[model samples]
Target chain A: MMTYAVECKNISKHFGKTTALSHINLNMEKDKIYGLLGRNGAGKSTLLNIVTAQTFPDDGEVKIFGESPYENGRALRNICIVKENGMFLKDVSVTGALDIASSFYNNWDKKLAERLLIEFQLDKRKTYRNLSLGMKSQLGIIVGLASRAPITIFDEPYIGLDAAGRQLFYDVLIEDYMENPRTIILSTHLIDEVSNLLEDVIILNKGEVMLEGNSEDIKNKAFYIRGTKDRVEKHISGKKVLSKEEFGNTMAVAIFDSISDNEIRAMELDDLAISSIPLQQLFIFLTGGKMIKRGDINE
Target chain B: MNRIKSHLKMHYLNSKKSFVIFWSIMFAISALGILISIYFKSRGYESVIITNSIVAVVIFGAVSGMVCYNETLPYMLNMGITRKDFIFGFAIYNILLSLIMSVIYTLLSIWEWLMYKLLGFNYEHFGQFFSGVKGIFEMTWICFLVTLCATVLFTLIASIYYKKGMMFLFGIGALIMLLMFIPGVTQAVFGFLESLVLSCAGGKGYIMMTLYSLAFFLLCYLIIYPLARTSQIKR
Candidate 1:
């Protein structure tokens, strides 16, 4: 029996007039790198916060290690959340932050921290305020990975890092996880960068779980079908059309259905443009490209 | 028990530097006061004794509140410590820090006594600063209570501000100021407190005030628990 690491049942939250999370139900298993992908205001942080007991949901319950996280210190002991903006104590040295983390988390790996310090090129003696934006983020990442908690969460962990630095983090994260199997919930906007590393992806759209499944399954779930407007419409008549656009007499339509390579090759002679939509492009089509106008619902 | 210990250790790590800074400043102030007393005695002026209990109380009181909001709450939570653990750990921190302060205050009084004995001259000192050799215990007791009272009260105030925002803080300040300006309110408040103090005067006073401080500490914790438990980290 594979035990779940995190389970949210009918969770919802609101801030005055704004709905932060609305009836979100999710279950995550142990030892997999889960990607929590969402556009801004898509309730990614709110869901992660509720899971870690950082914020209370307006409705429903959350369980970690098969126990409610509310006031459940034992359950939370195995969890770690690294926020986008550094939540480190102000004016404290890097070593001081690590010391405090080591004290709280029984499973803290000091050696990992020391190694990551070299990898990230962080100074232990420097105060948190003295670090550059990227350095501050690196410090947060070091703590998150080195804590060695069974359930580690990074809510947009790499906020301000160059390409090379981010690649270093992803490589370190995957290598570390491979050596030590644990549940990791990573939330980030740089979808395609970390997409391949994710085993499962959860997409949140306006405070609800829009799509979720095994990453490979989801990647093969959607494809683009292009041809004349009539041919494309005839081809996708029985399939779910996620979005469609027309350019002169030609049309490109996104279908939320898996198409086999044989069928795709079969349609090649039809003078149609056929290509699979990557996870990042599907994510944008599903959640992004919605610029709000004066009054109408923008999609 | 482990939760409390972890949280306490966590807070201790975060605040240890600040505590040392405050301690050094207090020691410098005490050293300066002692030097002035020695200089006055040499200049044919009356010898003086400047004890540190009052100064320690005032400084500790101011610091106790800022510690909670000074990135402590959010940092602790982000580190996976629960709110229950946080409050328990914070209480431990307050008791531990205040006890250390009280001991230092007592030691400063002892140092002053040694100075008086070495000089072989009676100093004109604020006699209440240290009651006597007996005052050492009393002074420690008083400092502990004052420290507890100040910390818990400030924590409560800070929690309120954290949850309620600047408008609420301004409203509270305005209401307090308004009440102060009203006739007889300030006198009534101070009179009540003074009477409470006098009622617990002598040996009875220290014990009673200590009990009161403990009661007030718990009260403050109870008042702030819900707010702290439900607080979310804001950007």
Candidate 2:
């Protein structure tokens, strides 16, 4: 039996009639990076919270390394979730927070934390409340990287980080992950930026799993076909069309299907354009297109 | 056990700065009181500086307990600490803090007594209010119990507030206000509280107070444990 680092089974959460998550099931394997992609209020944070036992699921269960994480220190010690806000107390200094984390995380890498502190240029003496938004994000990043927990999660860890800072984080993350492989889950809106870093992708759409598969496989299966309206419609007649957009005499339809090379060549010969959908575009087409007001847009 | 100890260490280190500030302000107050007493003595007037230092510690305990949930719970939960360990570690920290504060209060009381002897000024600590409690052990015991009870009670209140938010406090205030307007209810409530205090402080002396405070602490814990265990971490 293949062991999973984190298994969420039929998890559902409701907050005052708003369904945060609905019967969501996910299995994240060990030693792989996963991109938990979703639009706002798509329940990514809620799912992560339930997985980490920060909040209980209304139904179903979450298991970390085959053990229930809720109130189980043995199971919980193997996990670390760095949230976007309010992870550290306002009065706690950067060093104080790191010290607390080091004490709890048995495999904590102090030297890496110190090095990251310098790399991020965060003052050890600065209190959490006094840190800028970007600095606070850097602190969260340092903790997440240095904890070395078997299952490390970052929920919007680049909230206020600049482009250079985010690039640095990606570099450090990739370098460290290569040396010390663990299950890392990155939940963020910057899907394109982290798409390359993700081996597996889980896209949540309005409290449900819209898509889940290997990044390469998903991209390979999803395609955008652009041609005359009748031709595009005919091609996508029996396919799983995720989204459709009309531009005057042309129609573009995004579909998730496997096509043979001969079929693609035939479509290309007929003056039809076929292009592989980027992860971010695929994600938008899967989650964003449905919620948007199509009538408001000009063809 | 190691997790619990780690949580305890986190709580202690987080509160260390506050502890230092508290003691610094306390010593400053004591010094100012001594100066005023000496100046009064030199003018041939008898001025007594009655410092009920235990009150400050009790208040500190209450505030600390009330804020601990908000200040530390999210941070601990984010660090992947089990709720059980957090609560257990917090309970142990509370007990240890009460004991340490009691010891410090006892020492301060003795020091105040010596100052009184040297300066020929009357000094009365909070312990003198309880009749028949004469030794340092009794004083420390009472201090510990009172501080522990205050801490536990406030902790329960804070937990309730955390789970239910400001609405619970409003509901409580509204209930009290409604009860106060009812005929004979206010008197009945005050009468019960008065008797409860008197029975604890009356003929049985320190022993009764200790038992009463212990019972209160246990009751508070019984409520706090369930509330905290199931409590969700709020951002």
Candidate 3:
């Protein structure tokens, strides 16, 4: 039996007639990094909330380490979710917040937390309300990293972080993850930045799973074929077309399907330019967004 | 069990500074009252100094209980603390705080009595609502019960508001208003409340008041436990 770190079965949630999630099922393996990619209102946060047992799903169940997480301390202790905001009280000092977190998370890494505090240049004496948005995000990052839980999740953890800060986070995340392998879920809009770190990618669109598979496989399979209209259409005829854009007589089609080397060569010979779509562009296409063409904009 | 202890420790650490400030302000007020009494005494006039410190303690309990739900619940839930542990740990924290406040009030009452004897100043305490030395025990019991009940009741209200939002509160308000329009309903409600207060005020009714307060606390806990267990941590 394959043991999953986190599993959701037919999970559905609704808020006042708004379907936040609809029968979403996911199984995250242990010791692998996952990218939970989604647009706004795509139910990424709602799904994360349900997985951590912070909120109840209207239908279906969530299991952490093969046990229900709701009110189960044993099951819950293994998971730590750091949201973009409200992780600590306004009055709580940074040090106080860390101390509380250290107590709750059984596998807390105090040394790492202390080092991160100094590295991030966060003032221990400053209360949460006084910290700038970037510093607050840094505090959350520190907690998420130092928690060392079996299942750690970061939901848009880089909200106010600069490029350098985000890079530093990526470095530390990779280094620590290599040393202490655990299930990590990074839910963010910065798909391009974290795409390299993700082993498995799950894209949600409008309360449903639009795509889920190995990152390398998904990226390799997603390709943009651009050429004359007839050549592009004929080349991608049997493929799963994600989106299409036409500029004058030229047509660009994004398709998600395996391409053999011979077929790629044949498409090139037929005057069809084949290029692998970047994860971010592929995400946009998969989530019902059309690529903007220069001709269309000019017209 | 360890989780509960850690939670209690977190509560203590979180509230330690606020508690110090609260006591400092309380003692400052007490000192000012004493100074006024001494001034009146020096002018050959009698002034009675009444210390309603128990009221301050009760208010503290209520406010802290409500704030606990707002501040700690999300933080704990984010940290992966189970709702069961949060509620259990919170209940323990409430009981312990109530006991400590009750003891502190009892000692303050004794100290006030000593001041009355030594300085020839007329000092009355909330504890005096009950009789002499027996009043000490009754006062402690009543104070503990009141503080605990207030804490639990306020926590229940806050939890409901956190879970159900303003609509639930408005519904409750509307229900009360509708009941008030019915004949004898308002009178009956006020009459019941008056009797409940009178029961606590009269020394002989201490046992009854204690029972009523315990029942209230239990009811609040029963409602709050399930509400909290199922409550979502709002982002």
Candidate 4:
């Protein structure tokens, strides 16, 4: 049992009449990359906001580094949250924004900030309002990474990045984590793209913790089966098939359950292509793949 | 203290243009008033200080109110600075700006008086016009009151609006000030409240006002504590 770096016990939040989160219990390990996977309005941002003290949970308590962070400068100093929209002063240049963050965060690494600035190719003189969407996302990633806090949360921090820019972010993030080793929670819909980087995954749906487990365990736990329609249907019947699709005589079924060696061997002779479902597809099946539930699921 | 200093430095760097514009506009208006006084100095003219004082109060209220919200609020919120520190930091900045404005006005008045004297106009009452213990006290009290009022209002509005409060505060304050010129509105409003309070307290003027101020400050603090505490919702 590792000592949890962050914990949310029995946390429930409501906005007006709508419940944003319900009885949410989470324990995050230190120095692990945890992906908070959820659809839009699935309370990912709200949960991040609550955990970072940007928004308070309507009920229950949160602890970061084993202390209540509300108004606790010592605790907050060790935590940083970079929201997707980028909270920055208008008319403040990129350099000015970084200066402000550097001054505020005692652990702020100026060298890292400068390095990221170069990597992002952001002009220091350019004000925040003038930055393009991708540049803004890069700016947020730089801050979130450079703060060097013990706990850092990035809520969809790569909102508008091109492939190369996003790749740079992912690489720098992993490299930095290996050296610095902080508890990082990345909340985003780009599940498959980031699945390889995640050590753990917490899937949230309809304001509840639908699933949480080690990344490898979750991958091993979920599987997909494809074969002739009758054989696939016969094998998947009453086996918690999350979803099934059929085209002519071929059929595909997604099973959110463990498969034994005998079961795989038995299914093999049925001319089927049994494969592991990607994390994104797993999420799509788990959430019923409604447009609202499968937020931004582009390959 | 270091955090505050950093914030102050950031504010100064951010507010360079606005500070210059505000100070220039204030000086320009006061200079115009002094020039008009100089034009009338040959016979008898001593309204420069009074005119400048009036203008100063108006400018201080408007400028302080707007600056209190615009210059300090967003950046403070963004830095996750507590509203208690916010009130403290903003008070420091507002006081400094007020002192600077007062000093500049005094210097400019003296220069205008010298210019009038150089023009061969008898300006024996220049010292009497600009220098008086009573006037100094009055100006100090008014400036302090304006800053306090604006700060309280801004804090309340900030708590209500959260991060977007500053923008809403500026627009609302401007609208309220514009409405102050309406006939009988100011008196009707303040007088009614004052009378209501006086009646409630049964003529306990000093004690009542003191209790009211303490109570109001306490209530404001209670409200701000939650908003400031909200800064760490997810941390």
Candidate maximizing DockQ: 2
Model 4: residues with Cα > 4 Å off, grouped in runs:
A289-299, B27-94, B100-145, B148-152, B160-235
The clash number for model 3 is 0
lDDT at residue A106 of model 3 (Cα atoms): 82
Please, what are the lDDT tens digits per residue for candidate 4 over residues A1-299? 45578889988988779999988899998889999998888888888767766577889889888887665666667777887878766667888888888887777889999999998888989888889988889888888888887888888988889989989989999999999999999999888889999999998888888888899888886788887999998777767667778899998888877778888888898777889989998888777654322222210
Per-prediction backbone clash count: 1, 0, 0, 12
Q: What is the interface RMSD of candidate 3, in Å?
A: 1.3
TM-score of chain A for each candidate? Answer: 0.93, 0.93, 0.94, 0.92
What are the clashing pairs of model 3? none
**Cα error of candidate 1 at position A190, Å:** 0.4
What's each prediction's TM-score?
0.89, 0.92, 0.91, 0.77
Candidate 1 segments whose C-alpha is farther than 4 A from its true place: A227-231, A247-249, A289-299, B34-53, B116-134, B169-188
lDDT of each: 0.80, 0.85, 0.85, 0.71
Cα lDDT of model 3 by residue, B1-235, tens digit: 8888878878887787778788778767766766777787889987676775677898898999998887888878887888888888888988998888888777766766676668787666753434442656777887888889889988988898888897998899899899899999999999999988776664467778778988887888899898898888885
How many residue pairs clash in model 2?
Answer: 0
Q: Candidate 3: where are CA atoms >4 Å away? A: A228-230, A246-251, A270-272, A288-299, B107-118, B126-137, B184-205
Residue A246: error of model 1 in Å?
Answer: 4.0
lDDT string, candidate 4, B71-134, tens digits: 4554554455654666566556655555555555556556655665676554433223113323
Q: What is candidate 4's CA lDDT for residue B196?
A: 46
